[model samples]
Each structure stands twice: as C-alpha cells, then as structure tokens.
Target: MILSIALKEWKLLIKEKGVFIWLLVMPALFIVLFGTVLGNLGGGTQTLTYIDNDRTAASESLMTALGEQGGFKLEAKQAGELDDQVDRIREGKLGFLLVVPQGFAEKMTAGGDSLAAVELYSDGASDSAAGIRSALQNVATDYREQRLDAALKQAGVGDEAREQALQSPLQIEEKPQNATEGNAVTQVVPGYTVMFVFFVMISMIRRFIGDKTNGMTARLRTTRMKPLHYLLGMWLAYLGVALVQCAVLLGFGHFAYDVALGDLAAIAVLVLMLALCGTGLGLALSMVVRSENQGMAFVQLITMGGAALGGLWFPLEYMPKSMQTISHFLPQYWGQLAFQDIMTRGDHLSGILPSLAVLAAFALAGVLVALLRFRGFMKSAQG
Candidate 1:
C-alpha cells in the first residue's frame, strides 16, 4: 500500500516542470555563479605600479626585492605619471603605487643612521593596500639589517657577532591540520546544497494542500488507506525526492567543481537523514496550515531565515555570537556544519553522530506532530 501511494505521488511530481526548476536548475546556477566569482578573486598576479626617481642600483635593487618578496608583478611608470596615478587613486581607479624618492640611494649610500622614505600611495578603500604595506615594511627591515652589518664590521666585530645580532628570537610556522584543503568550491557547493534542501518543503506543502482542497484526503478513507498510512506515504514520496535532489547537487559539485567528498559512507548516511528531516517537517507543515498561501509564507520564512542564520551562505563565525548560538537550534545549521566537517576535515560516520542524532530528533518530532494533526487537517477539506 505504501509503495503504491509513493509511486503515484512520485509520478505526479515528475509531471510538474516546476519541480525540476526548483530542485535542480536553480541550485546548479547558484553553485556555478558563486564558485566562479570567488575562485578567481585571488588567482592572478596584482600589478604594483612604481616611479623610481632615484635611477640608481639601490633603487633598482629595491624594486627587484619588493617584487620578489611581495608576490606582485612590478610595472615601471615614468615620474611624470605620478600625479596622474595619485588622482586616479583618489577617484577609485588605481589600487597601489610606489615612489622611490630622488635622494633615496644617496641616503642609503651615506649609511650613518639616516632614514630613507619610500612613498607608497594607495587608495584608502583598497583591500590589497595592507599586503603591500607589510611587504614594504619587510624590505625596509632588510635595509636596516644591511646597515647593522656595516656598523658591526666598522666596530671590529666578527661575522659571528653580526649573525647573532641579526637573528630573530621568534620563529612562526604554519601547519595545515586538515585532510583536504578548503577553497571557494568547498564553501559554495555544500553551502547551497544544504540551503536548498529545505525548499523541498514548498512542493510538499502545495501537494498536501492541493489534495485536501480537491477532497483527495477525505476520499482516501473510502479505500483501505488509513489516515496515518496516507501521511506516511506522502512523506515517503517526498523523502525520495529530497534524497535524489541531494545526490544530484552533490554529484554536480563533485564533477563540475572537483569538490572533494570525503567518507562516502558518512555522506550517504547524512543524505538519508537530511531527506527524512526535510520531508518530516513538510508533513508536519502540511497538516498544520489552513491555506496554501499561509503554508508558502511559513516555508519562505523558514527557508530564507534559516539560510541566513544557519551558515548556508557564509561561515557561522561571521555572525554575531548570539546569532551563532541561536543557529544551534536550526536543522540547517547542523546539516551545513556536518557537511563542512566531512568535506574539509575528513570526518567519518562516527564523527558526525551528533549531527545525525539531532536530525533524527527533528524528524521524529515532525512525524509526531503530523500524526497528531492529520485528523484536523482532514476535517478542513474544502473540496
């Protein structure tokens, strides 16, 4: 009986063109658009335009050193262009410019504790300005070390003394502790996948409401189909739909973006639990709303509001602390967190048990609610 009803609902959903648009097409577009934009944001070389007024080996060496250490492609602009570049910066057209003053080499050559100024003009709003600033400071520190070496030699100190004098007391090392490296694809693919899963509620709500208004719910009682059986059948049908939707979205991410999916067993289990949670909520909502419009409004609220608060669009840490705490109560947050932990950290099924348990609890709660309200929902069949 369950299989027969589920098959009927599935065929009806397949006939609706909007189901494909909502479930597959929309999410694919989001993944492509966001993935491309963020993937290329920091990919290419940034040009650092400069005017070397010193015109000597010291100035040339400074430019070479800056280019090598700063991760930038250096471009030489004539001194005549400095004023135009400054104006462009003020007008938000240019990002960075370096000016080695005429007396810079003279000061370095004289070398008795005199400071040489290297002017860096940057647009106040530019994000790359800090990187350039820090690089220039490092170059200045190198020159200062050169001066120290010379002074030590003049004072009859040995090379050993100079080496000891210049050695830094602190050294910092960066260690990556995750199995897979994180990138824009990791963020966007799983993010939108978890977010759009909730949207399956809209279709479920519409179908359940349509059945009630058309007298399909009450009429089913004339057959062997019990009310609870009908509810379970509808939930089972949409659970399959949500599972297929997740599989397609995740598969698209893997193929199109090369997103690494870890722990296949964990992923499969998570998808099943996610489908149950989504369809279970839909069943509960289907039995509660008096009208399709009212149901859609609630769905939009849950979908959009949960997307924002649940770290579907961005990292939860980006939100305020209070909001982050609140997101713990949302199923979307748990789903997204589990996806990230698996895809990025290589968490297995055992590691994701807490998330799985939470989703199960939500599914159980929703199913209980649906069972309690099914009779009232049947009573309001307008058709």
Candidate 2:
C-alpha cells in the first residue's frame, strides 16, 4: 500500500514538465557555465618582460633563480625598451615588467647596508601579475643571501659560519591536515546540487497542498490507508526524487568535467543524508503553509537564504568570519562539508561522520515537527 502511494507520487512528479527542466537541465547548465568561466581564476605561472640594465653575472644569476622558481616566464628585452613595455602593460598586452637597475650587481656584491633594488611594474588587478611580483620578491631575497655568503667568504669566514648566518632564525613548516585538492568544478557542482535539491521542496510542498485542497486527503481517510502510511509514502517518494536528482548531477560532473568522486561510498552516504534533510524540511513546510503563495515564499527564503549562507555559491573561507559562523546553523552548510570532505579532501566515510550526524539530526527534527503538526493541519483544512 505504501509502495502504491509512493509510486503515484513519483509518477506525478515525473509528469510535471517544469520539475524535469529545473531538476535536471538547469543544474547541468550552471555546472558548465561556472566551471568553464572561473576554473582558471586561481594562481598559475605568469610572464614578465624584463630589461636587465645591469649586464653583469649577478643580474644573470638573479634571472636564473627566478626561472628556477618556476613561477614566471622571463622575456628579456633591451634596457631602452622600458617605455614600450609599460605601454604594453597598460594596453593589457603584457602582464608585468621588471627593470634590473644599473650597478645592481655591484651593490649586491658589495654586501653592506646598500641593497640592490629591482623595479617591478605590473597590473595590480591581474592574478598572474601578482604571482610574478611574489616570485620576484622571493628571488631578490635569495640573491641577497648569496651576496652575504660571498662577503663572508672574502672576509675569510668559514663555510659553516656563513651558512649559519644566512639561515632564518624563525622557520615555519606547513602541514596540510586535509588532502582536499579543491578545483572550480568540484566546488561548484556539489554546491549547486545541494541548492537545487532543497528547491525540490517547493514542488513537493505544493503537491501536498494540492491533495488537501482537492479533497484527496479526506477521500483517502475513507479507505483502509492510515495517515502514517500516507505520510511515509510521501516522504519516501520525495527522498527518492532527491536521490535521483543528486545522482544525475554527480554523474554529469564525473563524465563531463572529469571530477573525481573521492570515496564513492562516502559520497553516496552524504547524498542520502542530504536527501533526508530536504525531504523532512519539505514535509514540515507542507504542513505549515495555508496557501500556495505562502509556501512559495517560504521556499524562496529557505532555498536561497540557505544556499547563500551555506557556501553553496562560493567558499565559506572567502566569507567574513561572522557569516561563516552563522552558516553552521544551516543544514546545507553541513551537507557541503560532507560533500567537500569526500569530493575534495578524499576523506573516507568515517571522516565525514560528523557532518552526516548533523544532517541526520536536522532530518529528525523536521520529521518530528511535521508529525506533530500533521493532525492540526488536516483539521484546519477540513474546517
């Protein structure tokens, strides 16, 4: 009997043209659009046009160090070409330009309070330009240390003493706790999937309201069907729909964008938990609203507000600390955490158990609220 009701709900959902378009089509479009547009926005190698005015071995060594750092593409030009290079940078034809001043090698070799300064001009807005600037800074630091070593040698200082002098007094070793290799596609796909899954609530709630207004619920009371069976059937149907929606989006992400589903079992568990969260919220919402307009208003508030605060549109790391703190109250935040743990961090199911537990708690709360309100809601409709 429960299967029969569940199948009916599924069939009705499938027959709705709008549901098919929103659930399946729109998510795929967003994944492609966002993945392609913002995929390469992060850090990478940059090209710098440089004029070595100090045509000395020291300047050569600096350039070699910059090249060895592997963060810049060096384009050597004549010293007289500085004006032309600046023009190219302004015109967006070039990213950055470096001028190694005359006597730079002499100043570096002298190794005193006087320091060799290389002039770097770049578009501050470009990420590539920023990378080049950082690389240049590191190269200059290394060159300064080398000069110190040369000075020590001239002063008859031992090799070990020179090395000890050059070594940093304070050192930091970075160890990543999570193995998540974040990519544009991986970040976006799961986020949108969670956003759209919650969106399914609108349709599901509307369906429940329709059954009430059209006397379907009252008619069912005359049959052998218990209210528990009816409610369970609806929950199962919506849960199934949500699962299918996730599967389609994830499958598309895997095949089209080559997104790795790190720990498939963990991903599956997260998807199921998210589906439960959506289903329970939808059912609870269906019982509360008195009209279609109110239900839609709630849907908009829940789906959009949840997605925005939950880091569905962008990473929480980019948000203000307060905003990130507020996000913890939203179920979508936990869902994204679980998804990111598996998709990005390559964490096993055990690693994401906390997020799963939170989502399950949310689901339980929503179900309990809906069950408590179910009787009153039906009575109000009948009256």
Candidate 3:
C-alpha cells in the first residue's frame, strides 16, 4: 500500500516540468557551467597603478618582475594622483597600487634603507583583490631577495655562497590522500549535495502542500487510511528520491569526473544524515505553508539562500572573515566542512566528530519539529 502511494507521488513529480528541470536538468547545467567558466577563472588579473620615483636598474628589475608575473596590468601613474587612484579603486576600477619612493634605487645599491610602499586598495567586496595582493607580495619578496643577492655579489659573495648561508626556510608540502579532494569541487561536494537535496525535497513538499490546500489530503483522509500514514508514505517517497539523486551525483563525480570520495563509509553516513534532514524539513515545510505557490517562493529563498551562505557553489574562503565566522551557524556549512575534512584532508571519524555531531543535531531537530507539526495538523483536521 505504501509502495503504491509512493509510486503515485513519483509519477506526479516526474510529470511536473519544474521539478524535472530543477532536479535533473538544472544540476547538470550547473556542473557544465562551473566546469567551463570557473575552471579557468582562478588566475584573475588585477589592475594596479605603478609609481616609480627611482628608475634605477634594481627598481626597473622589480618592475619587470611585476610585469612578467602577468597577474597585474601595471599602469604608470604619478604618486600625486594616489588619491584619485584610490577613488577609482572605490569605484571598482582598480585593485591596488605600488609606490616606489625616491632614492629606492640608490638605497638598494648602497645596501641602505629602501622603503617601498604598496597601497592595497580594494573595494573590500572583491575577492580577486586578495589573490592579487598575495601574488604581488610574493613578487616583491623575490625582488628584495634579488637586490640582496646583488649587494652580496658586489661584496664578493657568489650565488653558491649566499645559498649556503640561508637558514630556516619554511617548506609546506600539501599531500592530499585523495587528489580529487584537493580541488574546490571535492571540498564543496557535501555543500552541493545538501543544497540540491534540500531543493528537491522542498519542491516535493510544496506539492504536498498543494495537495493539502486543494482538499486532496482531506479527501484521502476520508478513506480508511489515516493522515499520518499518508504523510509518512509521502515522506518516505521524497526521501527515496533524494537518496537516489545523491547516489547518482556521487557516482557522476566519482566514476565519470574522477571527483574524490575520500572515504566511502564516511560519505555514506553524511549522505544518510542529509537525506533524513531533507525529508523532515520537506514534510515540515508542507505543513507550514498555506499553499504550494507560497511554498515555492519560500523554498527558493530558504534553500538557495542557505546554500549561498553555506558556500555550496563557492568556498567560505572567498567570503570575508566576518562572513566566514557567521557560516559556522549554518547547518549546511557544518555538513560541507565535515565532507571536506574527510575528502580533502583525509580526516578520520575523530577529526570530523564536531561537524558530524552538529549535522546529527540538525537532522534530529528537523525531524522532531516535523513530527510534532504533522501530529498537530492531523489532530486539528480530525477535530
């Protein structure tokens, strides 16, 4: 009997164009779009103004290094116009500026104090500025090292001699247990999984709300079957669909795209938790909404907004420090972070316990709330 009801829900969902488009077509399209556009967008260039007061050989060499880095388009401008350039930066026309003060060339040659100012002007809303800043700082460090090398060479120290005197070089070797987890896609898979499952579940719940508002639920209740049985059957059906969809996506990521599934067992636990949460949330939403149309809007705002906050499509690393701090409050963020730890960091169960605990809490809370609300609705309907 439950199987028959589930089959009916499945058939109805399949027939709906919106559900079909969002569940299957939309996710596939996003995968393709991310692969095409964001795949090659990491090395974004920054527009920077160059203020070269001392056009010495060493300064010129530093400028050449910056130019050759190809991460920035160096614009030659005056220091006097720094304020105007800052205004341009505010207007989103520039990333940052580098100012080489007077006597910089002489100072480097004389092994004296050569102070160069790099004005990091960002709109504070731009992620690219951070990357540009990091890359440019590296270039500056290299240039300073080269200047030091030249000074040592003039003082009778050869390249081999300077190499021997270097002390305490920091070497950080990142070795990923699963190479796939090292990338953005692998780390973000959990967030994506949670987000899409929520989307699908929400859509299904909206359908349920529609059935309730249209008196289909009450009509069904008029039969010998109880409302709880109907709701349970519907919840089971939606959970089954969510599980299947998650399995398909994971399969695609693993077999087709070679995306990492670091620990299959751990991933299974996470997916199961997500399925439970989705089912409960979907069912609860069905009861909360007055109608399907209202549910649709609510679902979009809730699921999509949560995904964005949780860094499903992007990383929280791209967000500001404050935003990153706030992300911990989001359930999706906890799930995603746990997945990343397992997949990217090769973390064991112990390493991911906190995140897993948080996810379990969310799942349990959602389920309890849903059951309570569902029971209340059934009692009211009976009364």
Candidate 4:
C-alpha cells in the first residue's frame, strides 16, 4: 500500500513541471548564480572611496594593502567632493569614503603618529556596514604596523628588538584545523547549501496542497486506502528527491567550485538525515496550511526565518550572546554545523555523533507532527 501511494505521489509530482523545476532546477540555477557573482566579483569585499589627502609612501602602502588584501577596492576621489561623496554614499552611489590627512608621511617619518581618518558616511540603517568596518580597520591597522616596523628598522633597532618592545604581544596564527577550515568560502558553503535546500524544499509543498485541494486526495481515498499509508509513500518519494538534489549540489561544490566536501560517506549520511528531516517538515507544513497560496507564504516566511536564525547568511560569531544562545533552537543551525564539521573540519564519523543525533531528533519530531496532522485531517474526512 505504501509503495503504491509512493509511486502515485512520484508520478503526480513528476507531472508538475513547474514544481519539479522549482525543486530541482531552480536551486541549481541559483547555485550557479551564487558561484558566478560571489566567486568572480569577490565575497564580502567592500568598495570605498579613497580620498588620499596625503600621497606619501605610507598612504600608498595603505591603499595597496586595502586593494591587495582583497577586502576593499580603493577608488580615488577629489578632496572637495568629500561631502558630496558622503551624500553619494547616502544616496547609494558609493559605499564609504576614506581620507588620509595631510602630512601623514612627515609625522610618521618624524616618529610622530598621525591619524588617517576614514569618513564612513552612510545614511542611517546600514548595519550591513559591519563587514565594511572590520575590513577597513584591518587595512588601517596593517598600515600602522608596517610603517612602525620600517621606522624601527631605520632607527638601527633590530627587527627582533622592535618587535619585542613595541609590537603587539599577541601572535595569533590561523591554521586550518582541517582541509576547509581556513577557506572562508568553503566553510560557509555548507550553511548556504542547507539554507537554500530548506528554502527550495519547503517552497515545493505547494504541489501537495494543490493536489489535496483539487480532490486528488479524495479520489485516491476512494480506493479503500489508509491516509497514513498514502502520506508515508509521498513522504518517501519526496525524501528521495530531496536526497538527490542535495547530492547534486554537494557534487557541484566539490568538482566545480573546489569546495572541500569532507568524507564522502559522512556527507552521504548528513544529506540523508537532512533529507528525511526536510521531507517530514515539508509534509507537515503542507498539511497544516489551509490553501496553496497560504502554504507558499508560510513556507517562505519559515524558510527565511530558519536560515536567518541558523547562521545561514552570516556567522553566529557576530551575533549577540543571547541571539547565539537562541539559535540552537533552530534545526538548520545544527544541520549546517554538522555539515561543517564533516566537510570543513574533516572529522571522522564519530566526531559528528552529537549533530547526527540532533538531526535525527529533528527528523523524528517533524515526522511525529506530520503524522499527527495527517491523522487529524483523516478523521475529519472520515466523519
């Protein structure tokens, strides 16, 4: 019975080219788009106007670092246009403007510190400016350190002595604990995969709702079948589709984008677990919403909400401690973390036990909710 129902759902879903394209093809399209834009255009790099009032070697070096560091692209601007530049920034014509004060080289050469002021002129509500701020600060700090080191060397102090006496005491060495650890894009890939998968999968639920509303469910029920049996089959078929979609995405990341996807066996396990959980989630959501339109709205909202809370778009490191604490309640967070551990960290299967357990719990919870909802709807139909 379950097999028959599953086959029916599979055929029904296959007939809907729109839903199939949205589920399988659209995500791949977006992944290609993500790779094209983010890979070529540079990820997280900001464009700032470079108003070099002082064209000294130090300022030049700073500009070079900003450009070479691959964080911000430095654009030259006239000094008189500083305010207008700010207005342009506010008007969305630019990101921000940087100004190097006059006499910067003389002060540095004379052993006096000079401030290189950056005019971060953006209209109110630019919290997205956090990344830009961090990048610029890093650029500025590098300039100061390099200039100070050069000055100390010129003053006959050995590099070792200058470092011991003046340089920061902290020496932080960043080494990737695993293959994908040091690579920013690779580390975030899993989060993106999980986020978009959730979004696309949930969005596909409109097909199920459409079927239910068009008397398809009633027509099938006339064959003397149980609701749970039919639901189980549909769940299985969708789960299979979800698994294939995830596998294709992972493979593309590995072969095309050079994203280190960790151990194959571990990745398979993660995808399977997530597919199950997503299937149940999609099914339960489809049952709960009243109409196909309402289902689309609800799924869109939930998908975005889950991804936002789950560190999909950004790392949780920047979030408040309270928000971080709350994020654990989201299943997407755990799923991404699990993928990260497996793919980025190259952890053994045993290392991801906790996350695997959590994912299993999510799958169980979602399935229970879906089954309960199915039961309720079935009883109403029988009555």
Candidate 5:
C-alpha cells in the first residue's frame, strides 16, 4: 500500500515538469557555471597601465620588474594621459595608474636618501589597487637589493657573502596532497547537491498543503490509507527523489568536470545517508508547516543560511572561527565533509563514519519530529 502511494506521488511529480527543472537542470547549470568560473581564478594576467614621464632605462626597468614580479601585463600610456587615467579611476572605470616622475631615473641612480617619487594614482574603492601596490613594493625591494649588491661588490665582498646577505628568511613551498586535486568543481558539485537536496522539502510542502487544502487528506481517512502510511509513502517517494538527485549531480561532476570521486563505496553510502537526512527533514517540514508560504520561508532559511554557515559555498577555513564552530551542527556540513573526504582525501566508509553518524542523527531527529506531529497534522487535514 505504501509502495502504491509512493508510486502515485512519483507519477504526479513526473507530470509536473518544474520538479525536474528545479532538481536536475538548475543544479547542473550551477555546477557548470561556478566550476568554469572559479576554476580559472588564478590563470589570467592582470593589466597594469603606467605613465613613464622619465622615459629612461630605469623607468622601463621598473615597469619590466613589475610585470615579472606581479605577473602583470604591461600597458604604457604617454605621460599626457595621466590626468585621463586618474579620471577613469575616479569614475570607477579603472583600478589604478603608475606615474613615474620626470626626475625618476636620476633619483633612482643617485642611491641616497632621495627616492624617486613614483606615484600610484589609485581609487580607494578598487580591489586591484592593493595587489598593484604590493607588486610595486616588490619592485622597490629588488631595486634596493641591486643597489646593495653593487655597494657590496665595490666594497670587495665575495659572491657568497653578498648572496648570504641578500637571501630572505621566508620561503614558501607548494605541496599538494590527497587522492584528487581540490578545485572549484569539486566544491561546487557536492555543495549544490547538498543544498538542493534540502529543496525537496519545498515540493513536499506543496504536496502536503495541496492534499490538506483540496480535501485529499480528509478523503484518504475514509479509505484504507492510514495517516502513518500517507506520511511514510510521501517520505519514501522523496527519498527516491533525493537519491536520484545526488546520483545525477555526482555523475555530472565526474564525467563532465572530471572531478575524481575516490572510494565509490564510501561515496554511495554517504549519498544514501544524505538522501535520508534531506528527505527526513522534508517529512518533518511537511507535517509541521501550516501553509506553503510559511514552509517556503523555513526552506529558504534552511537552504540559504545553512549553505553559508555550513561551508557548502566555500571552505570552512575562509569563514570566521565562530561560524566554523557552528557549521558542525548543520547536516549540510556533514554531507559536504563526507563528500570531500571521499573525493579529495581518499577516505573510505570507515573514514567518513563520523559524518555519516551525524547525518543519521539528523535524519532520525527529523523522523521523530514528524512522527510526533503526524497526529495533529492529520487531525487538521480531516477537519
């Protein structure tokens, strides 16, 4: 009887084409969009436009240094264009401009306390200005080092001593670990999957509210379909929905983006647990909410707020410490953690037991709440 009811719900859902658009198509688009965008964040060159009033070897050398050190594309504007560049920055159309003073070459070669007045005309509102400033500082440091090297050479210092004097104390090394490289696609795929999984509640809310409003619930009481069976049947149907949703999303990530999904068994188990958790919450929501509008408000709070706080949209380390601590309480966090563990860290089922346990706890809690509310929910429907 429950199976029959679930099948009926599935058929109805299928006929409503919006369900597929919301559950499948939307998430796939989001995956493709964000994955392609955030994946190439560090790939492109940032352009630096400069006015070289000095028009000398030293000014050109500084420009070359900025390009090399900052990985910036060099754009030389005539000194007459300085005012125009400044106006563009003021108008928010440009980030910044570099202006080398007329005496720049002479001051730079003088090598005393008198420094070249190389002005970075910039808009305070610009995001790129900070990076450009840092690049300029690096160029300044290199010039200072060159001066120091020349002085040391004049003072009869050996190559080894000069090298020892010039070397910086800080060093950064890039070391990558794990079974698969972590990138935007991996983050975005499981993220949107977990986020939209909660959206199954919206459909449930619509269905339950429909039944109650249209007298289907009252009519069901006259038949052999018990109220508990009705709840279970609806829950079971959405469980299938969530499962298919997760599978399609993960499959898209795998085949389309080549996001490595390590430990297939572990991923499968996590997806099952995630489906249960999402659908269980949906069931509780279906029983608890009085109207579709109110249910939608709750769904927004759950999906959007949870996505932000649960680290679904980005890494937890990027969030505030308090937020990171709060994320542990959300099911989205556990779902995402389990997915990243399986995909990036090469974790198997045993490795993800904690996240699975947390997801299961949330699922159980939701079911228990729905069960407690089922009597009242049905009573209202019958009236």
Candidate 6:
C-alpha cells in the first residue's frame, strides 16, 4: 500500500512540466554560468601595460624574464602613452601599469649603495593585481640576484663562493595539505547541488498542503489506509526525488567539469543524509502552515535563506566570523561541509561523521516534530 502511494506521488511529480525546470534546467544554468564565468575569473592570467624608459639590456632582460615566466601578458607602451594607459586602467580596460624608470639598468648594475625603484601603478581593487605584483616581485628578485652575481664576479670572487653567497640563509618549502584548494569546479558544484536539493521542499510542501485542503486526506480516512502509511509514503517519495536530483547534478558536474568525487561511498552517505533531512523538514513545514499560500511563503524563506546563510551561495571563509559561527545551526551548512570534505579535502567517511551526525539529528528532530503535529494539523483541517 505504501509502495502504491509512493509510486502515485512519483508519477504525479513526473507529469508536472515545472518539475523538469526546477530540478534540472535552472541548476544546469547556474552551474554553467558560475563555473564558466566566475571560475575563470579566479584563475585566469592578467594583462600588464608597461613603459620602459630605461630601454637598456637590463630592462630588456627583465621584460624577457617576465614574459618567459608567463604570469602576465606584457604590453609595451611608449613613455608618451603613460597617461592613456592610466586612463584605460581607470576605465577597467587594464589592470596594472609599469614604469621602468630611465637609467634603471645603470642604477641596478652600478653596485652602489643606492636603491633603484620601478614604479608600479595598479587598480588595488582588481582581483588579479595581487598575483601580478607577486610575479613581478619574483622577477625583480631574480634580476637582482643576476646583477649581484655579475658584480661579485667583477670583484674577482671565486665561482664556489659566489654561489654560496647568493643562496639564502633560510629556505622555506611549501607543500599543499590538500591538493584541491583553488579548483573552481569543486567549489561550485557542491554548493549548487545542496541548494537545488533543498528546493525540493517547495514541491513537497505544496503537495502536503494540497492533500490537507483539497479533501485527499479526508477521503483516505474512509479507506483501510493508516495515517502512518500515508506519511511514510510521502516521505519515501520525496526522499527518492531528492536523491535522484543529487545524483543527476553530481553526474553532470563530473562529466562537464571533471570534478572528482574522492570517496564515492562517503559522498553517497552524505547525499542520503541530506535528502532525509530535506524530506523531514518539508514534512514538518507542511504541518506548520495552514494554507498553500502560507506554505509557499515559508518555502521561499527557508530554502533561499538557508542556502544563503548555510554556505551554499558562497564559502564560509569569505563570510564574517559571526556569520560563520551562526551557519553551524543550519542543516545546509553541514550538508555543504560534508560534500566539501569528500570532494575537496579527499576525506573518507570518518572525516564527515560530525556533519553527518548533525544532519541526522536534524532529520530526527524534524520527523519527530512532524509526526507529533500531524494528527492535530489534520484534525484542524477536517474540522
């Protein structure tokens, strides 16, 4: 009997044209738009405009090194073009401007106590400005070392001593704790997947409200069907729908973006727990609202608000410390964290146990609340 009711619910959902748009079309659009646009923005190379007033072998050597390093696309402009370049930067046509001062090479190679400075003007607000500055600093360091080596050789320093003198006293080596930090695809796919899964709440709440207000539950009371069977059927149906939605989204992400699923079993557990939470929350929300209009309003508030505050729209690290602390109270935050652990951190199921426990607690709390209120809500509707 439960299977029959669940099948009926699934069939009815499939027959709705809007279901496809909500479950697939909208999510696909978001994934492609953010993944292609913002993802590229985070990692793409910057273009730099430069006026080389020195125009000597040293300056040419610096430009050659910058080009070979491949951090920035170098655009050489005459000194007269400085004003125009600055204007373009203000207009967002360029990111950075470099002025290699006259006698830069002479000053750099003179081996005197004086310091030579190359003026760099940039849009401090630009995303690529920091990286470009870091690359330029590295180039400057290499060039300074070359000049120092040449000066030392002219002073009759032996080859072994010159090499030893150039080496830094302290060397730091960096190793990535997790290899997937800057991957844009991994960052976005899990965020939107959790977002759309909870969106199923809208459909579930609508069905629940319709069942109560449209005499479906009253009619079912005349049959041998128990209320528990009816509720179980609805929960199972919605959970199935949520699981399918998650699978499809992750599958699309894998194929389109080459997103790696580190621990498939852990990811499956996380998705199942999240779906259970969604189903339970939907059921509880239905009992809280008296009408379809009320249900719709609550649906929008909870789903959209949860997605925003729960780290589905942006990473928690980007949020203020207070917001980050508050996000722990949200089920969506735990869901996203679990997904990120598996997909980004390459963690096994053990790593996500805490998040899973929180989600399970949310599911249990929601289901218990819904069950306790179901009888009262139905009686009120029937009366």
Q: Which numbered prediction scores highest in TM-score against the true structure?
A: 5
TM-score, candidate 2, is: 0.76
**lDDT on C-alpha atoms for all candidate structures:** 0.88, 0.86, 0.72, 0.72, 0.90, 0.85
Winner on lDDT between 2 and 4 is 2
Weakest 10 consecutive residues of candidate 4 by summed lDDT: 179-188
- Which regions of candidate 5 fall more than 4 Å away from where they truly are? 40-43
Q: Which is the leading candidate under lDDT?
A: 5
lDDT of 1 by residue, 190-277 (tens): 8888878888999999999998888887688777887777787888899999999999999999998889999888999999998899
Q: Candidate 3 or 4, higher TM-score? A: 4
For candidate 5, write residues 175-253 as lDDT tens digits: 8888788888889999999999998989999999999999999999889887889998999999999999999999999
lDDT of 1 at 323: 98
Q: Candidate 1 — worst ten consecutive residues by lDDT sum?
A: 374-383
Q: What is candidate 2's lDDT per residue for 311-353, written digit by digit as tens?
A: 9988999999999999999999999888888888878999999
- Off-target runs (Cα >4 Å) in candidate 1 are 41-44, 218-224
Mind giving the per-residue lDDT tens digits that candidate 3 earns over 153-238? 88998778887655347878986565343664564445566678788656666667666666677677778876667877887788
Report how far residue 14 has shifted in candidate 2, in Å: 3.1
- Model 4 lDDT at residue 270: 83
lDDT string, candidate 4, 144-257, tens digits: 777778878989998779878675778999865665544445534566667656654454466566556666776777878877787787788788777877887777777877
Q: What's the CA error at residue 162 for candidate 2, in Å?
A: 3.0
Each prediction's Cα RMSD?
Answer: 2.3, 4.3, 5.3, 5.1, 1.8, 2.7
Score candidate 1 by TM-score against the native.
0.91
Candidate 4 total steric clashes: 0
lDDT of 1: 0.88
